[model samples]
Target chain A: MPPLVLHHLSVNYQDLRALRNINLTIHPGQLVGIFGPNGAGKSTLIKAMLGLIPRVTGRVTWGEADLSAHLERIAYLPQRSQIDWHFPATAWDVVMMGRVKPTGWLRPFAASSRRLAQAALERVGMAELAHRPIGALSGGQQQRVFLARALAQEAEIFCFDEPLVGVDQATTGIIFKVFRDLAAAGKMVLVINHDLGESITNFDQLILLNQELIAAGPRQWVLSPEHMRRAYGGEVGFWGHVA
Target chain B: MLPEMGPIHWLLDPLQYDFMLRSLAVAVMVGIICAVVGSYLMVQRLALLGDAISHSVLPGLALAFWLGGNIFLGAFIAGVLSTVLIAWIHRQSSIKEDAAMGIVFSAFFALGITLITVIQKENKIDLNHFLFGNILGVTVADVRDTAIIAALVLGVVVLIYKELLFYSFDPMGARASGLPVGLLNSGLMVLIALTVVASMKVVGVILVLSLLITPGATAYLLVPRLHQVMILGCGIGVFASLSGLYLSYYFNLPSGAAIVLVVSALFSLAFLFSPSQGVISRYRRRP
Candidate 1:
């Protein structure tokens, strides 16, 4: 059975249909990259998968079990711009929040949770800055911090929206490596991305979406000239090497 | 001319009275609660919400006072109802929260003032005191009510600290995480109402805005976490309360006004000296 299945998912916002009759299945250990233009329902798909939007009409299942049964097994990292980074929380505290529901209220964070937060930060090479306020970090560093926070969740299914935006080349490489490692560990990783060319090489499967699924399959099979034209409203062009 | 034989001699002797002790207790309780909750609101950029809620209680205060019932009960109902109205209007309509807040607070406060003027027909009901409280008139019931309300508010805040932080930092993320963001938002408003009424006697309606915002803003300069900031803010608030009361007695001045002044002074001092986020830290002296 596939790890995640979205069947006939339709989402509406007022008069506009953000997504219509979208159907897809992501198998276990697959690194799926969704490429689309603006207003092409990339982030909307992630939100629907997480049950964020109430107006969604669809059936989502995970590992042959109901999607709602595995709330703790899925981790989602929203776009970096959706947060108020000026909040007076340290990077460690923000990461520690991932352990809160499991630790229960009134109990102080366990030593294991602290170690895990530190380890997650170290994974993103941000362990040394744990004590720093989140507001003090640069945009790329802030993204890394949030990624560490999401990593601390230790979920089997990971979804990241535009994790590569506004980030340096080194951080991008680190993030891709982490995604590859997670996928190799028999976990599913889905990325809503816009870099069409690099996505073709980095992702094991490509899901081209434009308010609907334009194409889906192995990257080499689905990223042909005809599929690119449909997804991009024209030929998908790559001018310069990805930074 | 001896400072030890201070001008507050007469007022200090009043501490021997039970009413005076109750008044002081009520003031301190209100101070701690406001500082604890206010720290989060200030850091989360909701300082104006506190002010809006406080003024929004005016109509309720007038209604309760007119009915010859407990003023807090009225303000509690009025504050919560008005806050919900503002939140709903903001979400369901084109009006922004600021516009909703402006309209709601102004309408409530205006209605309160009008009621007071028309009903009392004079300042005999101590409208000024309610606007700017007089700590000297606190009763035993007032002290008990303040203690209970403060405890309840604090308990709720601590219990939901993680959820509140999550929502404040990123509402979309928190919603996606399946937190009840709407319920938490309403709970915050209710907590604010309880806090405003509890503080009615100490800082009065007029200067209570200072007590709500100052200690938290001061603590924000020194602390990096919400919990620590709240603790520090509470400490600053209590200290300001104690010092303000004592200084007011010694100087023969208003206790509530004195407390706000001291708290503001402390914020000014923090703004000057804090290392990382202080105003002075942002600028360097030319060598």
Candidate 2:
């Protein structure tokens, strides 16, 4: 698979610059985590890269072509808070949404798509509750359902924004395991993470940010004291396992 | 005293008149399309936008009447224009969407009322008919126009059901998945405008919001899926329209107000007695 590259990406919210010139290349088979403090544009970075939001200046490329033109190969899970849990849809319905574009416009989902959705639900241990309304699920279960949806997409690139927030330990374990499995299968995985705990160790690479690209490299290099100080604006303490 | 008529006779009595037949046809078609399109508005928390568009169509109606153009086409154009103006205002400034909708819709409604009052002097037009609906005045041409709009709206909805479902549930995710979200949003607006314009002669601009939102909301209280909500809402809307027309015929009530009242009554029943999400059910389950 071709690597994903971002060239001089920038985003602005009115007069405020949310993200500065960001340039990075993400290779396949890597589980990448984006780390930043509150308001650090971590979510903005993923959104801009995928063209979910307007980019002031940037180009995202998957191989030689513009990434926007090939969005079918991407599976993106937005922050849970951004979703309307009260929407009148069951878990099965949401998971089926992943198959909509692939099923082609004006065509209904095939039996194969149903099988994929069922398998994805089973993989997330949510098969028993597939018919439950999404709003009725617990936070962890809801996150897992969304993960199942992403899994059903069968995409080459996966981008999840804060998938671990407010989730239970079982969900966290399942998510990291899935991330690892995707990387092992040579799929590109990018996650926006808020916790600076031992969970940071699960990532193969780290992109530290504070309105700009502070550092982008292996976990150890990105977590260096100088980079952490520069990114967090102070000397910060994190899980020793990260170092 | 004349011989008492049976229930079937009472029901079939109104069908003998050409006007009642046309009115009923228009009402039933309007009811089905409104409920289907209104499900989107209900789910997206854009009920106010429905009200906005309904009210905004008035100016277009008056302008079309003045220009001797197709009134439905004018109403559709005006409804769409109001939505665009609302979006533009909210996006260009810090004003929130609800506030923007209120400002634009009211301004357009005022302009419409003013234009209609001025035009009523020369033509045999009644502003009250537009405001409260004159379903009895529906012609065969009106019935035909409504049928075409209903078919067009339902066809597009069926054709793009999954895309619309995904986009409504998660716009950012849909866009990230390579769906043209902007176009989908605009398409939804167009569908809503068409629904609103078609519904005008049956419910009028003032009460159209009730048809657009109440039935969907009533179904939402009983169903867990969007499609089920739409289906149930359609049933509820058609029943209300039919029964409301009957009530109007028997009791000499205004057609549009009677329909709105019937729909609201159905919503109240669902709110109070629905099995899963009703107030009474929740209260009963609490102990």
Candidate 3:
């Protein structure tokens, strides 16, 4: 059975169509890279998968269970600059947030939760800076901190949005290594990335999107010149301006 | 007989009066509730939320007085209703949050003043008192009301702590996590309303913003953790409440304003000397 399935999905913002006729299934342990230019509705597609957009008409199922009920089992890392970096919070504190479940609130983070958070930080090579404030970190370090937070979730399926944006080469390599490790462990890793040339060589599967699914299959089969032209050619200026 | 002098004499003498005891209880409850709720508001960057609610509550107070109903209940209802409206309009429009808050606060405040002038032209309630509380005027009922509201606000904050923090830090992520982002947002507004209503008697509707913003802001400047910020803010709030009340009794001033002023002073000091986020600290940290 597919790890995640989306059927007859359509996302609209007022009169504009963000996503149209999206149907796809992702299997477990697959490293799927969603590549598209600006306004390609890549983010919207992911948002729909996570049930973030209520205006969409579709069914998204995870295994046999309702996707809504199994949200805690999915770890999501948003765009790097989406949050207020100046927020007064420690790195460990931010990581501890991942250990929270939908139902537990009475007792604070337990010893096991703290150990998990610490291990996640250690995995991201952020153990030394666990006590540092989130605002004090550099761009790449912040991304790593979030990765650590997601790591603490220990979810079966991991979804990351623009995790490599503005990150340094070293940190980017570390993040991809983490992704590779997750995929190797039979966990699903989905990333919305713009770095096409590298993504072609790195990702095992490519989901080409331009407001709809242009192609979805093995990397070489889906990353053909035709797909790139369709996804990026017409929107070169638009993407450049936004980027 | 004149009140005794000396530190213990000054502090304990105020508690000797029944009204002072009531005022102290109300202020303590209000301080605790505001600090707890204000931490969330500060994190959400809805720093001006208190300002909006306090100003908007005037119309409700006027209407309640006109109807001969409970003034606190009217203010509570009015504060919650107007805040919901502001949040809804904000979500539905392209107008920025600051502009939206400004528009709602002015309209409601003007409507309140107009109603008060027209309805009670002969024996009007003192608007100044509402703006600045007379702590010595608090009664047993006010203390009871403050406790109940404080308890409710604290309960909700503790129950929905993670959900609220998740949304405040990462709204898109929270939405993606299948959390009810809209409901959580409204829940925060309701908490803010309850806090404002509870704090109104002690801090008054006018300077209530101080209790909501000052201690939290001061703590933010000094602390690096959310939990620490909350604990420090509550401590500062209680300290300001007690000290301001004692000072007011001695100086013949409004206790609420005095408390706010003291908290503001601490905020200034934190702004100047706090280790990491403070003005001096930031400069010190700079290479």
RMSD from true fold, candidate 3:
3.5
- Give the least accurate 10-residue stretch of model 1 chain B, judged by summed lDDT: B1-10
TM-score of 3: 0.91
**Listed models, DockQ each:** 0.53, 0.92, 0.57
lDDT of 1 by residue, A173-231 (tens): 88888888888989889898887556448898988888989998897777777777787
Model 1, B1-287: lDDT tens digits are 22655557745775887766886798778889999878767866777788888987888888888888998999888888888888888989889998998888888889888888876774358677678777667888888889899989999988888878877776766655556678878888888889999987778776777888898888889988888888899899998987787676667667778889899999998998788767677676424
What local lDDT score does residue B94 receive in model 2, on the 0 to 100 scale?
Answer: 95
Q: How high is the lDDT of residue B259 in model 3?
A: 91
Q: Give lDDT tens digits, candidate 2, residues B81-198.
A: 9999999999999999999999999999999999999998999888877787776768888899999999999999999999999999999999999999999999999999999888
List TM-score per model, in order.
0.91, 0.98, 0.91
- Docking quality band of candidate 3, CAPRI definitions: medium
Candidate 1 iRMSD in angstroms: 2.2
Model 2, position A26: C-alpha lDDT score: 90
